[model samples]
Target: MNRRRTPRSASAEELLSTLQHLTARARQEVGLHQARVELAQALQGKMLPAALPSFPGIRTAARYAPARDGLDIGGDWYDAFLLPDGALGLAIGDVQGHDVEAAAFMGQIRIAMRAVASTAADPGEVMARTNDLILSMDSSLFATSSFFRLDPATRELAGARAGHVAGVWATADGRSGITSDAGGLPLGIETGQRYPVTRRTLDVDGVFVLLTDGVIEGPSLSIGDGLEEVRRLVSAHTGATAEELADRVLRAAVLTGHEDDAAVLVLCHEVTPRDHG
Candidate 1:
């Protein structure tokens, strides 16, 4: 005797209903993920200082460019804070990696460096202390940083570098120069090694530009080419504000295919005489 076969179970209406439910769930999940990513980006934006402090007879502008990977929150950072004696503390640094971990490490080093710089008049001593602290904390972590103290009154800037790139100084007469030191190893490398500090006299209305290697180490261009590009862009926009010049440089870098994370801080000394009238 042949057994009667049972009819297949799922109905057209049932299949349609199931597909609709799955489609709705997928749309909901996509929306949630989008919101999460947007929130993360907002948080990263907040990590940077809301506004750079204003100083007497000085103008400052800065720009931070996240990488195209959307995880652009890297170890690169710039900070301007007040010292106890009213001298402004200016610094730019880049940790070895480029992720959330690097950003967190940058925050820690930034705070410690600020503290050391506030009390120590010598840029070398401040960097040495910061280096020692970073070294003593961990054996595997490393970073490169440059610390600078700008005296608006004297138009002088004293700075120390720990394997970071030398900043460029754009003179009022359209000449560009680099502030290069003998250079010391990056932080967390060798303890007790002294980093030398260099001093430069900035001209009135001159601009100093500090940047991370990300701005120079692109896949298409060599470091020298990047520097030349930066010089060209800055020289063309001599009348632009420090912030505007920084923005132009970074935009040009991206247009030229500098794919890594980028950061720039510019300080311009404006000639504003006291009101003796």
Candidate 2:
């Protein structure tokens, strides 16, 4: 008995054509992904401040690193500027998502917060005002933020939070711990929310470190462990300048290929003869 053989549905020529088409489509997809990544990074870079403001007795520094995965854009951002009242304004925040919309929302929020802070000069009020502004936008977005005002002349520090990660306060002798106060719901989540300000008289030689969650939540470590690692790294650089310290913290805590963007701000009040007197 002779058996009948089944014919192949796809010829060699057809298979080759299909493979070629798939290869071309793959290349197109890769190109599109690259363009998106580039655009996102550029938009984020423009949104963040190029340099932090400086003062006589206070040293300010900030660093932002884009995500090395996905779109290379995230909502992490930090800003420091001279307020109209002569108080240094510092803020670090992370918007809800890691898309282009999130990045654009972050820029608007940062600008709005700065404008509010320049006039209000109150950390709690600034956050509250920004919260109201975000609600007015009518977008499905929210953000966690820490807003602070520091008087370099008097070494007075005040801050408020909207469900953001706590900052680090390091003494002159290298001891450090989390510094956080009363916090309210994240901004844009609820209108007319109240954020209570926390005030502290930091030592003349103390440092206040503000950071986004990406800094304290490492790829392979828990937040607690990451905090400890940051403390250790910061302790080793107690004598470094604010900029140097910021760089060191990023180098030690954040890696090159982070899953999320990382942002940090460091404020240091150096003691002088007047402070001693």
Candidate 3:
């Protein structure tokens, strides 16, 4: 003969106790996640330059915004600093993802690039050396970056790209086009990658826009359409100040529902009354 067993029914107090335990665990998890996000954002803020240094004959402005979807802290960054030899070094890059790991990787790469800018001969050397450094770190994350060295006195712009977005060059008269001569794979893709240096004599009255892909690319927009939109925006702001133009571009991208973090750095020679005369 076999006997059937009955399931035990818990008392109300026991059930309440179990519910309380689960609630506490849930709260703990949420708290931990929030803390992680705040830490990541704070780290990002510290990594990015707080203020752009003033250049005598050049106007530069940069803007960075984290993606609104995820933790709101991402790997997109922009930097502009004066080198030892009087050249202005401008860099913008995006790591592989928009996570805490990606943010950490971006910080490392930005710091390394800044340290190398002092001794690196040119933009090509900077990218090449940075690529090597990232590889040596044994990191799995890769980054797309563009480095430019501008001589304000001579109006000479030399730069190199590592699978990054093409820069835009527009004169004060509204003539505009993309500047992407020397381009290669993103950093950390391989052990040895050479970034060709592209040299251009930028007109004193023109603007050089270096940006991350997030400004133009999003879930809803194709890359081609995004680039066209950016070009149109740039063309419309032919005579706007660098700060104004950067603000407009960043606002447009955000309002249009850009799904990723975005960064923009605008460089233009400051034309004085003497130049016009």
Clashing pairs in 3: none
What is the per-residue lDDT of model 3 for residues 1-277, given as tens digits with 9 covering 90 to 100?
8988898999999999999999999999999888877886788789899988656557789888888766777889999998999888899999988888888899999999998998986898899999999999999899999988888777788888999988776777768887647698999989778889988886547677878878877777766677677777887786777898898778767544687899999876655522321
Off by over 4 Å in 3: 1-37, 273-277
Tens digit of per-residue lDDT, candidate 1, span 50-96: 78876765777788877665454677788887788777788888887
RMSD of each: 4.2, 3.7, 4.0
Clashes of 3: 0
Clash counts for all predictions: 0, 0, 0
Clashing pairs in 2: none
lDDT of each: 0.77, 0.83, 0.83
Q: For residues 98-207, could you state the per-residue lDDT of candidate 2 as single tens digits?
A: 78888999999999999999889779999999999999999898999999898877877899999998887776775777764889999999888999999998664767
| Candidate 1, pairs of clashing residues | none
List candidate 1 stretches off by more than 4 Å.
Answer: 1-36, 273-277
